[model samples]
Target: MAMAKLVVTAVLVEGRSKSEVARDYGVSRRWVITMVQRFLAEGEAGLRPRSRRPRSNSRRTAAAVEDEIVELRKRLTEQGLDAGAATIGWHLGQRHGQAPATATIWRVLTRRGFVVPQPHKRPRSSYLRFVAEQPNERWQADITHWALADGTDAEILNIVDDHSRLLVGSVARSTFRAADVVACFHQAAARHGFPAGLLTDNGAVFTGSYRGGGWVALERELVGLGIRLTHSRPYHPQTCGKVERFHQTLKKRLARQPRAATLDELQTQLDTFRAHYNTARPHRALGRGTPQQAFDTRPKAAPTAAPVTVPAHYRVRRDRLDTTGCVTLRHNSRLHHIGLGRRHAGTRVLVLVHDLHIRVLSEDGELLRELTLNPSRDYQPQPKP
Candidate 1:
């Protein structure tokens, strides 16, 4: 527009030739001549540059359709569900009988300020991703923390299939012990069948190798079931990246809802999320199919034959009786308080454990107490005097 005005002013007011104005402005003589004629006929309005876009676009998406797309994005986001362009396109197809391409939907979202460009982030193609060939081939388990309504912290242990992203289990508790981890694993396996292998971090509840080189309850359970167990390298979380990523998604959804007041309430929320994640929510890695769909699409991998002999854990711990005349010993990943009579307070004893069978012997080699551990009870009762 500015160039057009300059050319027209030079030709009409300064009496410059069209060829001179065209050569000076580096414009075509025909364009300069047209501008001068329009200036004489229509005045300043003629010098305004015209739009290069076509007057009409028959193939453009309707205004109403773009509005629908934006509405769908808002609705999905408010519901704590995925509102990506592909997801919006999927929903639009269901409602309108025809949907714009994912790229078109993305452009619409960007134009509406709903999608921000992330040029600094790494490209998806640059990532080296791995997926199991069959469901239950490998399962990733991890624990994440969340705050309750009262600001108390809670832990959620989640197990997911690496192949299908199927959430096998999601258990909420005030704190998860090693025994709790094994129980959750069994619960999930009962429904989804045992996996060929299990992957987890070096958390104390998952492995004892980091602490005095002993077997945690979960490791023992896996070994007994003939399932291989692998731990992420120290300081390397990418080894269990799948479950770690799931924790983020789970927490994001939980953050959108009312904070739970108790462990039970949190467990209820986790259960609801597990159902939706497994059967309803579409996974981007799974080609926008639900985890359940991908899980059922192929045959499942199962654990091989059980080990010839599941190894028994044995250890000896020495301690003095506390003021309560009790000696505490951990057996099968459970702490047991054994009452040994107040008269024996401050007496030193050697606690020997062979699997569940426990023996307490005084320093003088005199047998003080012997009993098989009852896992269901936290306190082991002494025999009557």
Candidate 2:
């Protein structure tokens, strides 16, 4: 409109034809003629800036309502919950009874920094969406590196239930050894009931010192508890994404605030974080509800106790060891001196580790002793020093 008016003024004031004015000012001849007539009548007032505000603001959200929507979006985003306009509107209506329209929510969201531009290139799409039907049905485990104030790397092993997002275990360990993980698993199982399935990466700890081949002693134990052990494929961290994301949340949004003094000190912080993560922190998958909410709202379909079944080929042997913790097992006509180490005198034991050996667990399910064929090499790794 302004360009047309300028062309008309040029054509009339300079005594130029429409084509000449159009050529001079670069506007169409018809527009130049039409605007020149309008200018002749309405004068310079016809060349004023148009009103930017909509003629009718009927669709606009009220200032108070818009402010409320913005505030809610900020809060939800800070809590790591879904802050999309549609989600915010639903929440504000259903949860807070705002009953505002989606457009209002969107305007508020954009005004209050609730949206971000999509990245140019994102990771390849994932098809695997973990759905745990019941609590303790399946759990994911991983280890991450933390640091003490002294700058020493601390290996933190974490285990969390897939369904509940419960932090079953998060302990500081010097090494991510299979035996070390076994100890932590025992601690976690003692608190929460034994899981039916364990999901972990193909790290040395999960697959054992010797990789491949079904599973090591740790897998065997999980199998005994009626638990299925599955390993994420190598170079595929997304296979164990639940625990991986948990680690991300733990390090970035939560615990990077303070300096930790020691591993024990870090563990204390972990415990506090675990409580909040389970009960307070909202999960995007859980419809903006916490893990505890999902866990509690859902029914339990998992076993309360560990699976203790022996393999079909394996035969059960109930035996007793002497006061010296040595057991005499008749295998291939050889009396094997399995070291019980003065711990199991007259206890019923099951041989789970290897042939020509037995392990005794007390009435309280305590590992009373492990009678090993090679006692010297059992707990003691050969030392170079």
Q: Candidates' TM-scores? A: 0.73, 0.60
* Residue pairs whose backbone atoms clash in candidate 1: none
Kindly report the root-mean-square deviation of model 2 from the true structure over all alpha carbons: 12.9
For residues 120-210, could you state the per-residue lDDT of candidate 1 as single tens digits? 9878787678888999999999999999999999999999999999999999988999889988988998999999989999898987766
Writing each residue's lDDT as its tens digit, candidate 2 over 315-350 gives 344345567665555555554565555545665444
After superposition, the stretches of candidate 1 with alpha carbons farther than 4 Å from their true spots are 1-29, 42-50, 305-310, 313-385
Kindly give the stretch of ten consecutive residues in candidate 1 with the minimal lDDT sum.
305-314
* C-alpha lDDT of residue 210 in model 2: 36
Best by lDDT: 1
Could you tell me the TM-score of candidate 1? Answer: 0.73
lDDT of each: 0.84, 0.69
TM-score of structure candidate 2: 0.60
